[model samples]
Target chain A: MIIQDEDQLTAAVLAETERAGDPRVREIVRALVRHLHDFAREVRLTEKEFDASLDIVTRLGRLTTPSHNEVRLMAGSLGLSTLVSLMNNGTEDSPTSANLLGPFWRQGSPRMDNGESIVRSPTEGPPLFFTGRIVDTEGNAVAGAEVDVWHASPAGLYENQDPEQAEWNLRGKFFSDAEGVFAFRSIKPSGYPIPTDGPVGDLLAALKRHPFRPAHLHALIYKPGYKTIASQLYSHDDPILETDAQFGVVQRLIGTYERHENEPAPDPDVTEPWYSLEFTFVVEPGEAWLPTPPVSAQRSH
Target chain B: MIIQDEDQLTAAVLAETERAGDPRVREIVRALVRHLHDFAREVRLTEKEFDASLDIVTRLGRLTTPSHNEVRLMAGSLGLSTLVSLMNNGTEDSPTSANLLGPFWRQGSPRMDNGESIVRSPTEGPPLFFTGRIVDTEGNAVAGAEVDVWHASPAGLYENQDPEQAEWNLRGKFFSDAEGVFAFRSIKPSGYPIPTDGPVGDLLAALKRHPFRPAHLHALIYKPGYKTIASQLYSHDDPILETDAQFGVVQRLIGTYERHENEPAPDPDVTEPWYSLEFTFVVEPGEAWLPTPPVSAQRSH
Candidate 1:
């Protein structure tokens, strides 16, 4: 059909929803058509330019890989990741603020006992003693909640992506004990730059934007019969907290790093002074919680 | 802005385009808005579904790569490649029909003298002799036109991707002699399957579409003071000629392969007697034609 006007074209596309075989696809396509059309209109796109934009998008698809999430990076850079996360996690009343699962989560992380250190190196950075509890919305402890945690090292590389780090270094899964408590010894995460070598970097450069993400620790908490919480605890003082490329910063998700100064401890294990953070995860109760598909499941087109 | 209805959203977006800083960006954005908004209205998209669609597109951006042009494959499957090619090529009449340059063009092909065989395999397939000439619109020889040609092996794999074939096998660059005549010995090109291991494949599977491209040889003709042409010559009898996955089929691009029957003076040097194809390219007079930046240029996004 010759789509002369925007209205006619939109109406035609929306009408396809009724004939769409998959309801999910139909709804998704309709919305996509709207937003895409809206974005174009908002930008007053020309034919040649629209074609060029399509070319850009096409190139993006061709550049994807297991280690590189250019598509996800684009989404995150455009604030779409935050938008999706917000839409999915609408129970904003919950204590923990959700964030985008920034492209580095992998399966098969070794499980660790309570209070086990996730950091493979004891002297990597300022020692951080992190303690957290899993609780229901009503403030009652929820035992057996599994918490998955991971972070980049001082050099700003994930264990999986860095060959120098052993397998699953600085990454571990901890199950909350009877008291619904979990603790792990690790270094404070340093501020780092996102992978800026791909299309996302090109986009950021085009927009005259920076690619730094604020210092933060990644966390995913899950419990039976309760909504799983995917969140990050950002350092309160990190400069990028306000302008995170992924739009992932939330006030509720910020945690304070307390530096314990000059407290003489007799334990030889506590070599030097350290910083600590104590936080609690309050999950919403419900069986209707939306399940997050594993990264691999979502990796395919 | 609260985009309650499609019209208001379109208007809002169009107004925003007026404020766009870059004229090119403004024109492109306007067209994009119109097409995207029209598509949305045509589909009657809902907010919830729109959000999900946004997520999927974002993920697609994260998945881009140099070796894998998944986004291009997706766009091609959706007929976007043909549309872009048509728009770029304009309405000029020409001797050969243009087609999408499928993602396998490699650089630094070995230059061959006229009449040299592009086929390196002695036992690969039936030997075919291809003769071609470059001429102007008035049918006069246009010497010095460089013909770049490459094709898949009998097993339907490009030399670069296949380990068995030596580098630059079944691929060569030959400059037309002073008479504008060029010929090469090669096996008859065979139909090949597009890569089906990525999101592009997933999209095709979702659409219940086959991923076979008809047997064809890719060619790029370059000459000073004339329009450079990038095209493919398809075998007339290929079954998938009508329904190419990328919608790249054009009637004028099909070439007839004539079987050379038993001639008493069998050329012993040419083992496995096969067909012959002779075609000529007519160039349109112009300044040195500049080809579009290759698909790789936009891949870093």
Candidate 2:
């Protein structure tokens, strides 16, 4: 067909997608074409700008590897990841407990009993004892769910990114107990910068925005009868709680870390000024599955 | 600020752009974020799908190199390239002479005088004599413009892609005469399949779409007073004219290839079954600049 104008050209592409046998794919692709064409027209994007944008997209892809995912980072930085998470997991009234799994997640971390610390290496920081409850949307305990947890060290690097840290240094997994409780010990994670060495850094610099994701812990909860969720629980005390670089922060997912100086620590060897965080996760009933780890390989040999 | 919902998340991303110093970039980025979020919402994009998309993006980058650009290819497949081209050039009424530069255009081919041939090596196929005029929107001649011409051989492989072909074979540069006329000779290009061993190939398979672009001659016309248009004069008789894999076929840019069986050839040694094409390019007045060649390497040592 002769594509007479931009609208006609868009329609042609959409028409091609209809030939696909998969209805779901066809629908998603058709909607994508409309929005993409609409976006180009809305901005009156120039040839130079279009070429430059292609370069950016190429670099985002080229910069990604097993140890890092620049494409996913850019998605989070744009808030698309969070928006998708919200739309998929919960209703308008309840909001979603789901959040970005982020680029640091890996598959098959060591599993430990409840209350066992995931802090496997000599990591330095004030100790953080974390407790969490897993429940359904109706507030009933969701026991027996496997919860995989990982977080960045206070130095702003994951075990895969920091060579000094052991393999899976601040990473572990546990199952929710009969009461739907899971606990672990680790140092208080501090607000730190994201990797600014790639195209995403260029974008943040252009937007004049900081690359700090407020201190947060990542969790992926899995149970057969309920939906599995990849989540990040932001620390309420972090100053950038509202401006997380990934935009993964949700109001209800924020955990308040109580600072304690006089009370005895959870681990007898821990010093004063320790902290503790208590939070809960609400999963809905649906298909339960696991995500492929965005960065599966650790840097350690 | 705590981002409460999808709408709020979109707003927060838009809000961050106000900090950008370049209002044009700020505007474009804001629009991009909105459309991206809206696309996600319109499709109710799932976390698994989103993750899969990111994986697609990463492979698009990892597969790109100096000789190949999977990212740009995917954009062309999506029709964003043509949409951007039409949106930036001419009027909604006049349409655009500008088109995709495509992945095979290179930076410095040897320049030649008018009526010369660009077939620098042994190539198979009937001879093709291409003549074109450069004119402004008012139909006035545009003289002294440098025109770069290139096309694939009869075997449907560009010089850069086929190891047996010499560097810059079927590629030449010519300048418009006082009458705005420029012509070059090469083999009649056959429609060719795009490289399909990447994510774009995956997309095409999923869409049940073919990977062939209509046989076309590429031209880049540059003059100081008018816009530098990157164009492809698609063969009107090509089987896939209406279904170009890149979605780059423009209505007015299609050129008729006159076939001669008994007439004298343009060149003495050329056979009876040669083809000839004459077309006029209408350039709109605008800022002039060249594009970075999407692919800039030769496969041969």
lDDT of 2 by residue, B159-222 (tens): 8878888888989899999999998888788888998999889889999999998888899999
* Clash list (residue pairs), candidate 2: none
DockQ computed for model 1 against the true two-chain complex using alpha carbons: 0.08
Scored by Cα lDDT, where does model 2 land?
0.85
Lowest lDDT block of 10, candidate 1 chain B? B1-10
Predicted candidate 2 versus true structure: per-residue lDDT over A235-278, tens digit per residue: 88899987788888888888889999988998888767899989
lDDT of 1 at B214: 87
iRMS for all predictions?
A: 7.8, 1.2
Model 1: per-residue Cα lDDT over A1-301, one tens digit each? 2222233444443442454466666555456545654554455444456446665675554465545666667656655445445445534444434565666666657799877788774327888889988777777888888788988888887776676776677889998988889988888898788778766776666544578888889887777787676778888778777666665666667788888778742334776888888887767764423334335423222
**What class would a CAPRI assessor give candidate 1's docking?**
incorrect
Candidate 2 chain A, which ten residues in sequence have the lowest lDDT sum?
Answer: A292-301
Candidate models: Cα lDDT each: 0.66, 0.85
Model 2 DockQ class: medium
